[model samples]
Target: MALGLFWATVCLCVFVAVLSLDIMGFFSRGNKFQVEGRTVILTGGSYGMGKEVAKLLSQRGANLIIVARNVDKLKAAIEYAKSHAKNPSTQRFHYISADVCSEAENERLLKEATEWNNGKIPEIVWANAGSSTPMMWLESSIETQKQQMDMNYWATAYLAHKTLKAWLYPQTPYSPREKSAKAEAPRHFIMTSSAICFYSFTGYNPYGPAKWAMRGLCDGLRQEVLLYNGARRSTKKTGQEPAPFDINIQMVFPGNMKTPGHELENLTKPPITFILEKDDPEQTELAAATAAIKGLEAGNYYTSTNWLCDVMRISALGGNPRDNIIKDTVGQWLTSIVWLFVGPDLDGKVWNWGKKEGMPELKPEKRIAR
Candidate 1:
């Protein structure tokens, strides 16, 4: 009878948890990311997931300005996005060719985008240009490490700094009463990070740290934006002209994607790296972008593109905002318990690989193709 009662209690607890999650989902059903009739600037939109995101945003009625280094690819991407526009005649689309890794180029791109939008800054800016070169730490050169950081972290940081300054500290400040309804809506700054940001593996030494830095930047800015958003609500008491609108900082953690960049990354990936991540599922550019857009619309601060990415994200959530506090807490607890065993298992695999293969050569005979 005691055993029977224990089982019944466990079942009741599970039922209650399921019911609570259902209720939470019901309450959060409405779309929080409203992009209709808004201007959106998307970086690295010439190909892959960025291009897919641009197409999705066009379907949702956003005016698009896609930025990339290749003018021909950027032109193609713009045409593709325009073809999918919800209101083809009303929705406008343009492409800009510039290397975003340069700080001056970022400033110039934003200025041109603002001018194109008729003196209004874009309502949404997504820093989606990033690359990876996977190799052992010792095998990778200092130049490769610095290039990784510049491409993945510094590029996004530069664009984000310029965009936020324009949004939060405009030269021509206007009172709350002077802004229109469209201008009063929240602005979004989305950063594209990788699943490696949450966990590091052997072959990612050159690339993982850069993504981790991007995650750190996102976390810090997420908290700092709260101060400005609060000031917007208390403008009367502070007697200062409020910033135009609330700024929402979000980040996307995408796992293995089937893109040209991913293909290039695989050319340099160590055999051990492949073995470690073989079980991780891969998503197409469209699928990954679709999942990211869904997460944004659901108002998630840190969006994960796949189940494995979600697991990694929750395991290292730190101070990031939770999508659902109860759900995230439960997930964190479960992930911690699983990691207790999984962590050692991974380490054992790496140890066994070294024992079986011995030390690999410092450099392979063939250099990675650019």
Candidate 2:
């Protein structure tokens, strides 16, 4: 038993040392990518996190193509972008007002953006529009659920579909010369999936599942974006250079923020949710945007602010991951079991909430308190 314990200790130490090195990037991918002078199409850019992201990128000399359903707000966003840009003389800003949930609208936005930018595909395409209607799953209508899917999932998917054609797909004989001309210029596709993507609370309901679906899609898309090994070998065998596969996929899972929508969500949020969120009321939009930019520049495959989000993210990595490995599959299972046990109790509390004196309906008839 003494010898077995000794070996176990040694193995654990070795594992920690390796993981630590990987986390420190001693054995990680190069993070030399730059956002400077890049053209970007940012959805939901009128206000909140989207507006903040635009400001940060503009300050770094990136051109902005801001989109949202609010023309007045989008125009203001463009003015902000222009004034703050590192090189205002060289910077360009455009605004479009369209509902991002419409695939046709998104397609038109993409077309107009590319055309306005002198036929240059944006270096970064950011899907930042998202919404949540707070209610229990049973209380939320199917329309409410579908609205979440449209904004959080389909919008991102449509953007990725259009952008990746220019960013990822390798050139063929039939490929357009203009597309093949520039070896993919390290394009970035950024999507905003909430920290709730990792786990859902009682009041979050459909919104949580919608975000989870978005995260799952991002994971699968990350894998699918890989340039085929066969293509790489074939190029080398034929003494031809392989096309550059510089498309970077980044998904940010931000914690609660002091956005307008957040205020709207709070009216119906569960008492238990506040207990779980126990952190300071709101992480400023600026702070969240800063963390996101830093993470993207550092090549983090998964970027987040809250401790809970990080814990859940690190715990979800598989046999192969680009970074973050605090524990293995077995440890993750154990951790999940703990949450699983806690989950039912949370539900029970919620169930009892309904039975309490003057309890508000999960879908309160009047959302905001007068």
Indicate which candidate wins on TM-score. 1
Residue 50 of model 2 has an lDDT of 88
TM-score of 2: 0.82
RMSD to native, candidate 1: 3.1
Q: Give the alpha carbon lDDT tens digit for every residue of 172-285 in model 1.
A: 332013354354778999999999999899999999999999999999999999998988667366545567588999999999989888988888888999999989999999
Judged by whole-model lDDT over C-alpha atoms, candidate 1 comes out at 0.89
Global lDDT of each model? 0.89, 0.75
Q: Write out the backbone clash pairs for model 1.
A: none
TM-score against truth, every candidate: 0.92, 0.82
Candidate 2, residues 171-262, lDDT tens digits: the string is 42122225244445566788999888776777677788888888888888777666542354353554444445456677998888888878
Indicate the residue-level lDDT of 272 in model 1. 93
